[model samples]
Target: MKLNLTPLFAALLLAGCASVGSVDPAPLPLAPGAYKTTAANDATALTASWWQSFADPVLDELVGRAMAANTSVQAAANRLAQARAVLGSAEASRLPQVGVAAGAGRAADPGARAITRYSAGLDLAYELDLGGRLLHERNASALDVQAREQLLADARLLVQANVARSYLALRALDAEREIVAGTVAAYGETLSLTEKRARAGDVADLDVARVQAELAANEAEALALERRRLELETALAVLLGEAASSFRLVPATWATALPAVPAGLPSELLQRRPDLAAARSQLQAAKARVGVAQAAWWPSLALTAQGGGASSELSNLLRSGASTWGIGLLAALPIFDGGRREAGVQAARAQLDGSAIAFREQFLLALKEVEDQLGALTLLRAQGEANARAVSAASQALRLSDTRYRNGLVSQLELLDARRSELANRRAALQVRSAQYQTTVGLIRALGGGWATGA
Candidate 1:
């Protein structure tokens, strides 16, 4: 059987048209010599397990649990598996499809006599990729797999960072709580002494009331800090893929080693982020699709083959006289589709353009993140020192004021002011230290200094 098809210059189509699939999908590459903000030393190299740099056993354990159990990471892994399956299908499209069949039936022959007809056969079909359309499609699918793999890496990195940040912040809250608790005890002692003096007629009741107010305020602040710490712990539990009721991070010493990064990092480090790599993969997949769209302008060719045997008896199905075979090639071209092909090309190109812009935006964001974190770390370091000095001065002033108040050399108001100053400065100093820890982790993540692929 035959049907009329849009005719092509048979020779030209067979020989392959030079301009048939001519579309260059220009890809973006990271700029050479990207501003050198690399790691400081060999020990600081970005590794798959970067959380180890902190040297906190609890943190290391939690991060490990998160990487293995986080829901987002598991979801990404599922996606990667799906992408790989899709890639396998795309690859199969480029290979020969073969099948076998056997059948027996009762039928009437030309003489109108009943007959038992037995048949067995094998068939094969394949597309000849003259325009690389199928090839591009397969390549695009492969890129999708790559992108998904990178996305999996990205999910792990995000979970790791959040765990470290939340844990460190919780520890900071503990430190602050300790400071407040100590101050509360001191205030309690002072209040008791002030009340005794009031009863002895050495100090007025106003002094006792003032001490009471200060003690209550510090106690309130301590409770608020505990509330915040509980919230952080709950968030961490989710990150670790555990039920909040079953998880608890008890208050302990914050001994996580704070690692420092170096100045003027190299350009190669810029491309290490999984998110950035995923973006690049997405762009390449889009580019491959553009090529697929371009290939659509060319004709498609297919090759078919079959071998079979037929006989009146099942035993004779493969007999010498019952054998038959044939082979053929076919071609198809769409003469007109009212600009549908053109529209496809345009859509694909548009997608490619958007991907390019997205890639650029990601690159710019990467740069800004690194810079912001670096600057923050520097400013925080200096701030920590200043807060330390303030705390020291405040502590000394409070000690002197307490002594003077006992001797009646300073008023109750002056002593209370000194205590407030010392508490505020001490809390400020703790906050600065916390910022340094949190910012260091941010710097590691923002700088894309973690999770090397295929590790």
Candidate 2:
């Protein structure tokens, strides 16, 4: 039978143009216009280094160290480098491959004189990307590199937030410890007075016992705060990539001034979050892979050319008669593989679907995080105000009880109770303040380092 390849070639060319089955991802349902708690008119965008807003030099230095040396951040950076290398390799594969080879061999037969042969050759081979397979593969690799880059950004952001929170917690603990120490000292003075009054037969021994118990309790509370401070210091050291045992943060006060963050329109959030960007990049990569899989169902064409010279003597290898050269074209069409190509196409489509869904989920998650932090800050601020009033009132009541006790107008037990209430109120106020600082950090992170109006 005489074969006519025109129709076959035409059909294959047209099939190669078919699009992948993967669907393009679209914007998902997220919070609308503006955050409920944040101002809508402020237009400043989030700073790249949001931790600087804390205005603490120690915290700033710690965050910087974490970003530079934290293990998670370092690992992510390495992954980005690897992805870039893969992308380079894929792109290079699209061009022709050329190489040179040289060899020498000696052979002897039982009834023949020994002889030597020498050869040298240059070869070139290239897969003609007539089906767009190589192009799509390279596109996928490029997207992978973008995804890895975003992942690295996410890692850095997490490290910075962790370091900030740890350092702030240590300071909060220190503040609370100071309050306990103050209470302990007050109890000590009261105990001394009760002992003197008892010796003078003006107060009973029970009064002395009560004051001693209060002093012991405050001292115990102080010890617990110290332990917590030590733990936080160790955590911060690890974040800075240093040995926990060898690292220490000097006692410092927590910064109460929280910089107001701009919460931009929800639409802009998709672009600001690194995790969302990473998900979107992965979706693009998966879509490209679908095209690659579809391309595999069609025929592949390759062009190869080689020129070489061979001779018994190395000096004569390049002589005109001893030289040789050839050119050829190769094609491969999937004949049958038990539906393997179909399975691959289905798998690629499935992966594309997964990636698209993942992108949507990531968007929703980011929105939820932002809202949660906003709500926390709002409520915590109100609670903080209430706590401030309680502390003030308790302090005034304690002063009255002390004066009355000094004049023997009230029992020692009543005076001790007043002191305890004052200490508790002070500690509660400190806790609310600490919570505000911590939640503010969370809000910044949830907003993807910061936000800008109209962003």
Candidate 3:
């Protein structure tokens, strides 16, 4: 039997001439605009390291360490690498695959004859991509890689925010510890005065006992604050990829200055947030996948070339008379596979729809976070101011109470009460200030800080 390769070549050429299928771009569910909220002028510009606005060098260092060591950031980087490799693999489908082959063998007849044969050939196969299937796949893979890169960026931003928040908590606890220590000292002095008065019959034993109990409570509160600081340090250590027991965070005593928040529109969040950007890219990838799946419905055309030589002697295998070459076409049409192809297309369409929804959801969430942070900042600033004034008034009251007690004009109990109020107010002010600074950091994070605005 003789096989003619001409017809196969003609068919492949004809298939190449066939019109490529069209892929409709998926409709983006979210409008290409900033988010909207009831509050006007709530938008703020984002800085990349918004934490630096607090002017805490220790916090800056901690954030740098976490970015270098955080496991989640590393994981996102690894995922991006995987996506790039996948894209490379998809791209390879567009080029021809060629291979060389060689063989030698001997055969023996059952009766008496023996023969030797030698052969060698070059083989090639290429998908003509008549319907741009490989192109669609490559495009989808590229978009996936982009999406993964954005995901990595998002992870980094999250880690930065977490590290900053933890650092702020640690500083707040330190402030509390200081306040408690001062109160304990004040109580100790009051207890000493009360004890002397009791011995002199100027005051009752109850006054001495009351001062002692207050001192003990202040000491206990100090101890609790210490514990909280330690816990925060441990958390920060873990984020830096260190053993909590082995790592220690030095207490930061510097006053944190709040950074100015950039006023921006809600719609700016969509452009600034890496998570939102990644979500949009993923939606694009999903849309491209729909095209890839749809391409499955069209017939695929492939071209193959195989040439070889056969001879009784290995030396003559490459001779023209001993060599044969042929080209062939392979075509696959989906006849009926229980509707698998159709099902795949439908599934891809569903995935596209899901991605669109996810993108919109993410955008809206980002907007809400920014707006909420803005509102929180406004409230916190007012609270901080009120607390500051309260601290000042409490201090004045404590001083007046002390003078009155020394002059025998007020009871020891009144003096003790004034001291306690002063301590509470001071501690509350410290905490409120810390809260205000942390809220500012949150606003920066929500705004996507420096990186969000092309920093």
Alpha-carbon lDDT, every model: 0.81, 0.78, 0.74
RMSD to truth, every model: 9.8, 9.4, 11.0
Q: Candidate 3 versus the native: TM-score?
A: 0.87
TM-score of each: 0.88, 0.90, 0.87
What is candidate 1's lDDT per residue for 1-455, written digit by digit as tens? 11111121122122212232332324423333333233334335446677888889999899988987889999999999999999999999999999998888999989999999898999999999999999999989999999999899888888889999999999999889999999999999999989998999989888898899999999998899889988999999999999999999989987888776654554445566788788778877888898899899999999999899999998888888998798999999999999999999999978877776676678668767876776777788789889999999999999999899888898989998998999999899989998988888887787465423332
Instruction: Tally clashes: model 2.
Output: 0
Candidate 2 minimal-lDDT segment of 10 residues: 9-18
The deviation in Å at residue 273 for candidate 2 is: 0.7
Tens digits of per-residue lDDT for model 2, 240-285: 9999999988886665456664433344444667887788778778
TM-score of model 2 (CA atoms) = 0.90
Q: How far off is residue 391 in model 2, in Å? A: 1.0
Judged by TM-score, which candidate is best? 2
